[model samples]
Target chain A: MNGCMERIYNGLIKENPTFVLMLGMCPTLAVTTSATNGVGMGLSTTVVLVLSNMLISMLRKVIPDSVRMPAFIVVVASFVTIVQFLLQGFVPSLYASLGIYIPLIVVNCIILGRAESYASKNPVLLSIFDGIGMGLGFTVGLTAIGLVREIIGSGKVFGFQLLPLADVAAGKSGYVPVTIFILAPGAFLVLAGLTALQNKVKNNAAKKGKKVREASGCGEGCASCGGCSGKVFPTGNEEE
Target chain B: MVLSENKFMMSSSPHIRSKTTSANIMQIVTAALLPAAAFGVYNFGLPALIMLISTTASAVLTELIYQKLMHKKVTINDFSAVVTGLLLGLNMPSSAPWWMGALGSVFGILVVKQLFGGLGQNIMNPALGARCFLLISFTGQMTTFIYDGVSGPTPLAVLKSGGTVDTMSMLIGKIPGTIGETSVFAIMLGAVILILTGVIDLRIPGTYLATFAVFVGIFGHFQNPDIGFFDPQYITAHLCGGGIMLGAWFMATDYVTSPITKRGQIVYGMLLGILTGLFRLFGGSAEGVSYAIIISNLLVPLIERVTLPKPFGKGGEK
Candidate 1:
């Protein structure tokens, strides 16, 4: 039981899918423009993640190594369709907001990464816990970023005006929000700021003689770090 | 006898320290900038002064607080913060509120400067980076330039609208625009001071102007639909109107951000000129000076690498 708990904790903190492993940054940057969209996207991804991990773990022995990737995609894509229809039926508003991103979650690196790294190698029950933990970690990261962007960018949080101003509610002019938080650049900036905050915490941990894994790169998404073989794809470069 | 004894003073050869410190150099640059900043305050009135002071104070405070929290030496005394603050303030419209100034200064110092490993190690010019940030964040607020009872578009805007601008008003700084950029005369006065002290060289600024002049002389007629190609006064008006003068002399020639070698500086300068021309003529916005310099600043490393000098006396000896 303790071992199972540790697996959960490991995914949540030790290799948080967003901040630590830096997986599934597409939805992490895109749907995180608003708090409600963040929670909705996160939950939908969580459902897909849990079910897919279980299916992948169950079929690990049956699936051949050469066709593992294709097999995994077929399972993931199947789960995504069900989730999409469910969202479209029950929560039409969220489906509308998420738009293409709801379907894009099938390709979220976090889902496939967990299936490949943990599920394919672990027991079915343990893989389920790993999926739950990683999904929650991604949720935490996305919600935090979304909340910040929403409040600063629009002076609202989760559709409620926490910092109420005349401009947002009425047509009158009053407090001007820092609109950058909601813009495209705001996503990159807020993510950078949060990563910087995370690094500061890690550095503090190191000072107390605690073991903390050093993080490298600016976390400006894969586009910036794609060519930086020293940081991102160390294994691929080494093999080459 | 003392001189002879001191000549053998236990140190390596070539032992003379110049009087120039970072603080002193920054001070000289600040002094050179005072005329333009003063003119901005005079022309734009009290709000410009408030914005200038707020930005300078915020920059110094951000540097001090960051260094303090990080357990490093505070370098606010070096006056680079003040220079960055002044330049960023000048880049902004005089109508900007105190918060924009404060935020811009803090962002420039903290994110652009300290996070990139402090003063000398940043990849881009901090002030220009902050200006771009503010421009992106507050497009509506940043673009509004109101003068007295009359609110009008900037000269660049006028040209973009297929209308002509009076060259004298722009040179004399009577136009409604960013606080420090309207006056060609004041910017030139500061540029002269920088040039004479050898703080800035003619290689970059000269090539920037020459290329810009040639480029604008050919294409600037399209900026004003009424004018035909190659009018001398129209070309001068194009040069005098925007932040090009301020950017070419002050921002592009930043010591840490610009290329080191002579040929590299020339290439860098011409690249800036061409990009400015392309953006000014073809881009959506009327002003392209800040964007052009910031983009050129990113290319300095490549320029330096290509212009690296060959090793000394290697060709003859080998």
Candidate 2:
């Protein structure tokens, strides 16, 4: 129970797939134009991550070490297809909105990264918790970015017009949408901004005598993000 | 080039260094820009004046506060922020709301300039970058120019159509346009000051204007029917209107963002002129000077790499 809980904590905060690990950047940047779309994409990715983790862990010993990569993908893709059909049958609107990204989740680095790094070595139970944790973290990140972009870009969130778009349309001098926040550049700017914010929080914690890792280089790309959020634990925790 | 034997041993190079600080350079640029700024104020009245003050204040204060909060050296004394603000101000329409000025200034100085690394490290001209940002973000405010309840089409807009313009009015800066770009004479006066002080490399402005002239002349017949190829009025109007004069002299010559070597400067200038011609002739907007300068600014690194001064003995030895 303790090890499983730690895996969940590790994925959500210590090694967040979106903000900290920066794993599935394609769908994280795309398909996050609105809150609803972000939630839909996130939940769909979550289903794939969890099922793929369990299958890979179950077949970890059975799969030959030589063809482990292909074996993991086969398992992940099967689960992704199941989620896709489920989404297509039920939430057709979400399926339509997140059109290409749903299939592309088969190649999402987060699923593969966890399979190679965590799930293949860990027990099925711990791997399942890790998937849940990383999925929730990714969901939080995507939804937050979508919330900001939608609120500023369209004055709406989850199809709710909190700022009343009719005022802008009628020229009644109300809140006008920034419009750029929903554009492509907005994704990059918001991503950088959110990443910077996370770094600031971690740095502040480090300053307060917390046992956090010091950020070394300029935190721009994936090379700098690997060891973020104080990856103090040693890898190869087969002892558990 | 000989160094005296008075505690000044002949260093390998850079014997005589000018004592002009970045602050000094910025102050010179600010002084040189005074005539054009005054012309903007004269042409557009209180609104233009308010814009200048507000923009400049915002840029300076933003830089000051940003540096202070970031625990870096406060560099607002270096009038680069002021120059950035003033350039953004000049680029704005006279009828632009007050907040636009502050927003643009802050965006230019803070985001474009300081964020990339203050002063010398910015890759793009901060003012031009901010101007483009404002143009894209707030299109209506950036394009709407009105004075005294009379809003007239800008000379560039008129020229974009097949209409003719008052050449003399454009030359003397008595036309309808952005706050400062309307007055060729005033801009020329400032350009002269910049040139005379040796603050500007005339190679850039000269090649830029010449290339612009040649390109516009070649493309004149296609863009306008009233003016034939190499037509005098067409050439004058193209050169005089649409921030070309302001951009060629001031923005393109920015020491930090522009190419450094003589050959590189000429290439940068010619490219800028060609881009301006292309945009004016075929682009969505009438004025292409801002976009052209920025595009050229981006190419400066590549230009410098290709056009570095040859080692002294390499060519001779070969």
For each candidate in the order shown, give its overall lDDT on alpha carbons.
Answer: 0.84, 0.84
Best by TM-score: 1
Q: Which stretches of candidate 1 lie over 4 Å from their true place?
A: A166-174, A202-240, B1-16, B221-226, B312-318
Best by DockQ: 1
lDDT for position A40 in model 1:
91
Tens digit per residue, CA lDDT, model 2, B175-290: 77788898888998888888888899689999999999999998988876666789877888899888999999989999999988889999998999999999999899888899
DockQ, all models: 0.54, 0.39
Over A32-145, each residue of candidate 2 has an lDDT whose tens digit, in order, gives: 789999899888888889989988988988999999999998999899999999999999999999999999999999899889988888767667867888888888889988
Q: Which stretches of candidate 2 lie over 4 Å from their true place?
A: A62-75, A164-171, A211-240, B1-15, B220-232, B315-318
How big is the positional error of residue A164 in model 1, measured in Å on the Cα after superposition?
A: 2.4
What are the per-candidate TM-scores when only chain A is compared? 0.83, 0.86
- lDDT of candidate 1 over A1-240, digit per residue (tens): 233454556666677777878788899888888999889988889999999999998999999999999999999999999999999999999999999999998899999988888788766666776788888888888888899999888889899988856453366756577777898878988888887788788789989998764333333432432332323312211000
Worst 10 residues of 2 chain A by lDDT: A225-234
